[model samples]
Target: MAIDPKELRRCLGHFTTGVTVITCQGEDGTPHGATVNAFTAVSLEPPLVLVSLDRRSRLCGLLEARAFTVNVLESAQKDLALHFAGRPNQEVRWAADSACGAPRLDGTLAHISCTPWQAYDGGDHVLYVGEVQQFHIHEGRPLLFHSGQFHHLGGDHNPLLWDDSADGPDAGVSFISTLAGTRRV
Candidate 1:
């Protein structure tokens, strides 16, 4: 039996995700974007990321084998997200120049530019994987989404698990070592 679409969406909504605007240049060389939450870091070896866009979205067609920027939104950029999601905010800002051939949005938490790596059919969505070309990060908390609402990071314990350190659970060996001490193996 087919699952109810609303039920599926409600179940998926439990998974919190970072908000982003996937931007690409149109055929006319103008910037176009869509607010996307289905973004993932696919690989680190070649530095790949993936964004799933609905097959009907114009941004999906514009991204065919082209460069794009995944601008992770800051906590304060909910209006920008709404704008790209089709609400039309006239005062939306743009960066001075393009990054990796795609227009960059201003005041984002992070900007990751990429060239098209591959595309795959994802039912009603198309998963576009991109090879990392350039990226920038600013010191700020990310915008988040969950359960059909915009959210933000909370004061959780030890939220920053990894950092610029040479140590601290960096490998499987360290995890095994920690477990070995508590087990009689």
Candidate 2:
């Protein structure tokens, strides 16, 4: 009747997720953050997002007090991810989000600023649903986390593959031309 924690973690590791570092500033004016993989787009209608944090983490208190920013790291930013996730002995620098005052890492692929919408108790972790007030996208492939490691996407050694089932060559060309607006020479 009981489930094994190791097995549960191993099973969940099979599901790949984009890595992000969620950050906020504490009341004492200190920045706090943690490497998080439990973030996702909740809804488009209201522009919502969700990030789960362990109740005991220092970042949880900051998130409870003020707004937060989710900095989605690109594949090139794997060091940033690992740095934030590393031991407390390592020093990390964080810049404040100009719009919301939350802490954010520089040169992220994308940043989403949000106000806390609602919080629900999820066992040891609390799920904080946020209403995205502002966001910005940049050009880069996302850093993927799976099987207890960070994976780089879309490189010479690891190229992106389109799902063939989605369309044929003609459809692909049309889609690219429509998106790009023209062909070069």
The top-ranked prediction according to TM-score is: 1
Sliding window of 10 residues with minimal summed lDDT for model 2: 175-184
The candidate 1 region of ten consecutive residues with least summed lDDT is 175-184
| Candidate of highest lDDT | 1
**lDDT for each residue of candidate 2 in 1-185, tens digit (9 for 90 to 100):** 89998999899999999999998877888777789999989987789999999898877766874788999999888778877786555456555564767777778899998888998898889899988888888998899999999997655664434433435545544322333354422
Could you give candidate 1's per-residue lDDT for residues 1-185 as a string of tens digits? 99999999999999999999999989998999999999999998799999999999999999999899999999999989999999997686889655578888999999999999999999999999999999999998989999999988766723423322333455333211232242211
Q: Can you give the lDDT of residue 25 in candidate 2?
A: 79
> What stretches of model 1 exceed 4 Å from their correct place?
155-160, 163-185
User: How well does candidate 1 match the true structure in TM-score terms?
Assistant: 0.86
Query: Between which residue pairs do clashes occur in model 2?
Result: none
